[model samples]
Target: MSPALASALAAELTRRADEDRELMRQAETIPPPDHRRRIAQCHRDNAEALATIVRRHGWPTAALVGAPASTAALMILLHAPDPGFRRDGRDLIAQAVAEGHCPAIHLAYITDHCAVDEGQPQLYGTRIDPKTLRPYPIRQPRDVDERRREVGLGPLQEQLEALGIRV
Candidate 1:
């Protein structure tokens, strides 16, 4: 891991996170369509930057880029519009997790996110419906908590409750 490369990645992650915070702050004041467009643009930009970094550095695991930047890289891929790109990122993270270089919880989030992006029922119930404040469809609802536990995530209902959403 080049120190320069790690520093650059950290800077990019910080900038992106700042932009995300600003977007959230402005969300209520901006027109809905405009807010959405801004968000889409932000995702596109972050995705492209992250894709380039990935092409050069693989998955940017914690060993390579530090934990926060590694997690931020995952987030950039998560918000990307292309389902295939998200799937590919998730696959890379899955491999990293298998090698003990990444957290299983990261894998859990991306796995459920990709499932939701592909219109399939989530395996871990990680993706929630913003409108309803509930998890999106889960493939095996009965086993969700068990699956989440295997990946270091708490129960889905507990997560929802943490968000102040009554389960």
Candidate 2:
């Protein structure tokens, strides 16, 4: 990928992150009904934007624009209301990882999320409740720590602590 394209994508990713973060902050405040609406709209628009970019450029692998930009794209799509869009992004990211272009961690994260989204066992136990700050129950609880370790994720205790959830 050209430097210009990489820069452009990185910039756009940064902008999306800022907007999303601001929306989240607003959502945390009292009387955030308007912010809730704004967040939904923002998510829809961001999803469409990523879809368009991916359709044109395939998955933006780390080799294309650095890992930051690629991961940013992955994160935005993960929260998308449409499961199909998230799965599409996951497939592209997985292919890139297999081709040695992107990091395997991205696939690991997506795999867990997609698994939970599909009501199956999540390998990595990454998904958490927004309101309760607790991770969704993993399918095969006994094997979770092993799976997470394989994916470069830290201990579940550390992960939950980092998310501000005790236990």
Reference-based lDDT, each prediction: 0.87, 0.81
- Candidate 2 lDDT, 108-127, residue by residue in tens: 88887888789877777788
lDDT of 1 by residue, 63-85 (tens): 88888888888778778888889
Model 1: lDDT of residue 160? 86
Residue 14, model 2: lDDT of 61
**Alpha-carbon runs more than 4 Å astray in model 2:** none
Model 2 residue 61 lDDT score: 81
What are the per-model numbers of colliding residue pairs? 0, 0
TM-score of each: 0.93, 0.90
For model 2, the run of ten residues with the poorest summed lDDT: 26-35
Stretches > 4 Å off in candidate 1: none
- Could you say which candidate leads in TM-score? 1
Model 1 steric clash pairs: none
